[model samples]
Target: MSRVVLRRCIVRGRIQPARTSDVRAPGPRATAPNSRDGATPRHSASHDNRSRTEVPMVSSSVGGVKSPRFFYGWVIIACVWVANFVTVSINPLVFAFFLDSMSVDLDVKRSTLVWGITIRMISGGLFAPYLGRIVDRHGTRWPGAVAGLVVGLVLIGFAFTSNIWIMFGLFFISGLTGFSIFGGNMLTMVPPASWFVAKRGRALSIATSGQLFGTATFAIAAALLIEAFGWRWAWAIFGIVAIVGVVPPYALLMRRRPEDMGLLPDGATSLPVVEVTSAVASPTPTAPVASATHREEPDFTVAEAWRTPVLWANLAATTLLMVAISPFLLFRNHYWTTLGFSPTLIAIGVALDPFSFAIANIAMGFFAERVPIRFTGVIGGVWRGFGMLPLTLGMTWPGSVVLHNVVWGIGSGTTSVFQTMMIPDYFGRTNQGAIRGSITPIMVTVSALGAPLGGYLLDAGVSYIAFFWGIFLAVTVASASFFFQKPPKHAPAATDPPTRMPTST
Candidate 1:
């Protein structure tokens, strides 16, 4: 008779067996029990005339031991921070400074100039659903890298274009490519949501604080460049920075999820394991199993999320707030100039807005970890509404200018973090991009109206003060809407376990 020895090892979440050479044995061959009975085989040295032996089962490093190295998720966060800092600046942040200069150079109304942004928004909104699906399926690296390259080139195009139509066309292209790919919530916000579950609030806040930091830093930089070399050259300089800052980091460093690297979310060091029973009178190997804890996260698909009332309520609130705020933001510099502030002072003021925003964003991020995000949204909306009151006071007290921005910045920063975290927190990460993208058209359509409407109203002799008051009213309503939002429930199939709703916090 011949005896066979078998060894089992765990590799990449699976159990596989390795066979060793057969050995000669006396009498009847010893047989092992079936694995399904959950019984261990026994051997007697006297009966079988064979020596007892112990076999070691090999386990994957991810399952066997914890690594002490720094988590790669933080690295992803840093890369996203850099990407956001550069990419977001080129559009609304630094681009705001270029509006007056571009209007003058292109011989167009400021209203006409801002239509470029409106067009960009519409086009980006149209493209968002597809981009979301791509991010969900393929990951962020290629899409982000391509977007950075296109946006950089578009900025360069803006530097040389004298035709307003051509400029609008360029804006349209940017919307389809750059903004759709890496700008706003897609690249900057989504990755952090997928990478960390427990630390999501802080992670997203830190990642997105780049927007405020970039706004503050680049507002000053854009001002100096516009003053020194004129707006065309300033745009040219920004284009170069965009290419350098955005392209390399995303291409080399960005990953879709922590699982791709054989790591768990929130820097969890050990992989979950299930014991395997073998019949060969040898040690059994353990195989990696999906974490039961992680599966509890709510994974509402796009269609399912759309059916929930909370989604609609949140979207409605978001839409109203954006519609109210967008025009004010578009016309802020122009309105301040009318109040007799110097360009230098206006530049300093603009820088101050986001500096305050950065401070509040980090602070609120910590607060969000312990509180339900809806409450933060409510507080932010009410605070921002009051912040508008200071603006209605006009330059009557120049100090009011400082007060309005600081208050508005803190409110906006708090609200921004709330908005970014809400969707992922309510819906699981698996299909979040698609769920978020589905709402883009509604948000973009209403928000896009702001710039053009503000331009038209100003041309028709409506006072900026009236617009400020209207925003205050709109924000109040939106704040009240936040009280109605709640986490949505999903109907699971018969075979699926009942889904657990995340704690309200």
Candidate 2:
């Protein structure tokens, strides 16, 4: 018989690798369920398994060993990391240097341009749930690849769009299409899921730092790029960077898991074989809370992931609270200028954005790794609500817009990071793309609603006071995603005691 190169497949959480090397050498305990088996997993990130059978199998290649996703997986993470850095950078970059020129030449109101910004925000934010669902079912490789490709294309397409409607369509496409970040939850969880059991916190925190580093470095560069090139050229250049930068690494380096290569989780032999395999075998969740778990360990199935009362509460809270900020951000110049700060001061304040966001995102990343994921959302609520102090006071105090912007920026930064990170914590890694993507349209709706609402308020001679108050109010209430989330029957506890990944992507 030709020697086959299949890797071990788990049966009821036990990893029984029928290796040609070890198949005949093991003692009786090696073949049995040895509680003392020295190959336990370091950490097991939550996964949805409602439709998955007990065994989690990875098909072997012609060469025999199942391909470890890590060999090529890091490549995807690097690519997405660069692209996201470039894509996200475009927002603040364009606003700082090109907003006035673009607005005037396009013959649109500044608030209209706000539509472009908000459209993307809503698209990305709303679809987060759907994206999570996709990752849960299909695994992470293809979705990340596809989303990177489509985002690159959409951004490139955006450069040539001459019509406002076309711009809207393309930008919206970039935003909505890339809703696959939740699919990357596996990326976030890998540190905890695949590394030292003792160092899960530190590992996850370090990995999360990539987001802030990417955001900050790219954002600052975007400012300079916009200053040098016209906005159109900036778009073209940045789009190219996103596409060219992300696709190759993703194709060449990224993998879905260490198990794909026949190695045990974390490549460690310290854990029992059965425990290690079971930890790696379970699929991540992408559903309502009630259906999220196979049982009580903060893990759940996609079917029950979001259906719990917790989902509804957080859903409402997250959506409303998040919606308030983007419109304001899109029109920051106009809104803040009205408070009568000079251009220099506004410039100074706007420059603070990357720094504030960098700080907040970095902090949240560490928090995600160390803190209870639920508290991240709650923190967002408190931060954002209180951060609006500037908006409320700026009109009365000279140069108060800066203070307001500072507070709001920090709050927005924290809230954004918390929600962005929560998909993995809540839904696990199952069907992540679908779960995240489905919500994209709601963000669109919010953007559509926000633009006109802000405009109407201004046109009706309403004060910024109302606007700031409204923003703060939403933030105050937005903590519900955390407060209201409930676990399925299988979860270890309904409390938020649970906690939890990696790379630039």
Candidate number achieving the greatest TM-score relative to the actual structure: 1
Clashes of 2: 95
Per-residue lDDT over 1-505 for candidate 1, one digit per residue giving the tens place of the 0 to 100 score: 2233332111222222222322224333222211111111111112222332323333346553444367788989998888777766556646778888888877888888888888888778778788888888878888988888988899888889999899889888888763522223576667899888767778988987887788878888888999899998987887788889889998999999877877767765544422223233423322222222222255678987898898899888888877777778778778877878777877787788888888888888878766677777887887787778877755555666677778888888888777887778777788888888888877877787877888899889998888778778888999878866766645444454322323222
Using alpha carbons, what is the TM-score of model 2?
Answer: 0.67
Candidate 2 lDDT, 391-475, residue by residue in tens: 6655555456556556655665665555654443445433334544444455445544665567666657777677777766766
lDDT of each: 0.70, 0.49
* Residue 272's lDDT in candidate 2: 23
